[model samples]
Target: MNQHRKPRAQSAFTQRAVRVGLFAAGAAGIAGAVPAQAATGLPQHSAIAVDQTFSRADFVHHTQARDSFTVRQFGTVNAATARNQANAVGVGCSVDDHCRSVALSFQIVTMAGEHTHLNAINRGDAVNEHCDGCQTLAGAYQFVVSTPRPFTLDKGSQQKLADIHRRLDALTRSTLPATDLKTRADALAAEVNKVLADAVAKAPKGAERPTVTLHRHLDGWPAH
Candidate 1:
């Protein structure tokens, strides 16, 4: 079966939208406890939750306890885009032996300039949509590689990881003066698509088969 591949720019919306499915990779091993200073902060209640239609693995992301931003960290997502990515090549952190537990959490402070909603099915139907300002980001980005256990990516897939990571790290937060619902939703919306893309790219394709689908509710799911 020939699955149509989308252009890089075209996947923007789809990329961000599919984030809901990312939790499916829960079986993959993860890393360890990070310093309070390393986590990315935003605002929200409960860890991220999956729509349940995405996959079988139940993964949730929590907020609240996090490291205060102080001192420079290495290989972090740039503050510019309000995005972050972690690469744990081959060795899954959560599934790996002796690997400590790490956290993956963030809040959608702003929507891409595209039209979207707080609870959007796709970037287009968002209650607050604004594609023009999709790149205008204004928020925080956080991802920490705990001590002892670090984040890695599949060697062959490292490049794919970097591609997605760069897109995530380069997200521009929403503007301050434009305190509007559409603008905020638009910015946050893009990220949703990005997450989906990540899940699609990471999914087990071929005979094993890769799965990709976005249902709803990725808020407050933790990776416990």
Candidate 2:
């Protein structure tokens, strides 16, 4: 009985080994059947940049004897810029396996400057999306830096200037009668001149004016 049991055990072990070997051979065959391109996969990378600049100059001269003249100049500038850099890598997929990868980049910068005195520079990569193994991801990054001409003004004068800016914005957007809007805008212009004169007259003697630089950074996914 012991001898018979020994032979049965040996037979079972041999059969299991044969099954394993067959399975390995079949797996190798399937792997070999896969296209070389699919086995090595493909990688993609893209980069894009957009740059724009605008400049305008207007000169007006009028000579008249005993005549009152008023000149109003209005200008508007709108600009948009976007930079994108994307990279996608696929690490191969088996014949019986499904694998997908996606990479995307999107960027948009919009600015509306009234009176055309604003200078905007958009630089650097704004978005990067990475994915591996059927994963999906979206990302957006933005860096904004603003440098303005240095100026020294008292706190009161600063507040006045802020108020003037608000009023001007409102007047521009108002739906009131065209003549009324014009009148209000003209008044605000006069106020601006007066504020500038007062600021210059009351400036501190030998005041140390420091240049200010502003930096802002945004990172994450945006809805819509």
Candidate 3:
């Protein structure tokens, strides 16, 4: 009876050892499969709560803490067809190994300019750009060219611009998903298209129609 009992005890101990060994191997496999960052308890990508709720004070605080860039290309070009070109006019700034929000405002204001071409472009990857991973929070470009040459902006065009301005203001203040922001941006571009078309139609014949091309590119959003 003693011999049978000893053999049974040894068998149970062997089974337990096997189970422990299997568990250890499984744990090792799982650890090996994990990424290097995970192994080091570091996150590869930080999360951005696009649709998170925050107060106006919080928005102002974040905006003030980050970098801001404003540019105005104002003046009249006497030439019938004047051209103004700016590349990477305004950009954002990074901080604390992460990106911060930035505000970029660009305006082209002139009085009575005929056949002017305004090009304002902000490419995120400029050679001297400092905002490597910065996000654009508020951005706008106002192109106002008033001419006394019998060219008037119709009410419809004015309304479109107003609507775009309102939407842009809301976007600057609200927290929205990237996709949603992109949709709104596309809509704004569409409105701009209509305004341009209207301008062409209203311009007198044999005159160089004033043209303005504004391009703004920001991180986490499509180019506008």
lDDT: which candidate is best? 3
Which pairs clash (backbone N, Cα, C closer than 3 Å) in model 2? none
Total backbone collisions for each predicted model:
77, 0, 0
lDDT of 2 by residue, 187-215 (tens): 66456556655654543332222111111
Name the TM-score of candidate 3: 0.41
TM-score of each prediction: 0.20, 0.25, 0.41
> lDDT of each prediction vs. the true structure?
0.23, 0.25, 0.32
lDDT (10s digit) by residue, model 1, range 1-224: 21111111111212234211112111122233222222222222212211101111112311011111111122112221222211111111232221111112232221111111222121111110111111111122232111111122235434543444443333212122223422443444345546434533553333322222222211111111
Question: lDDT score, residue 115, model 3?
Answer: 38
Best by TM-score: 3
Tell me how candidate 1 scores on lDDT. Answer: 0.23
Q: What tens digits encode model 3's per-residue C-alpha lDDT throughout 1-224?
A: 10000010100111111101101010000111111111111212211100011111122233321222121222333222111111121233334332334333323332223433322222222111343333333333333343324344557766766666666556644565435654575566556656755674565543344443434333331232
Candidate 2: what lDDT?
Answer: 0.25
RMSD vs true structure, all candidates: 21.1, 33.5, 27.1
Off by over 4 Å in 1: 1-174, 177-209, 213-224
Query: Better model by lDDT, 1 or 2?
Result: 2
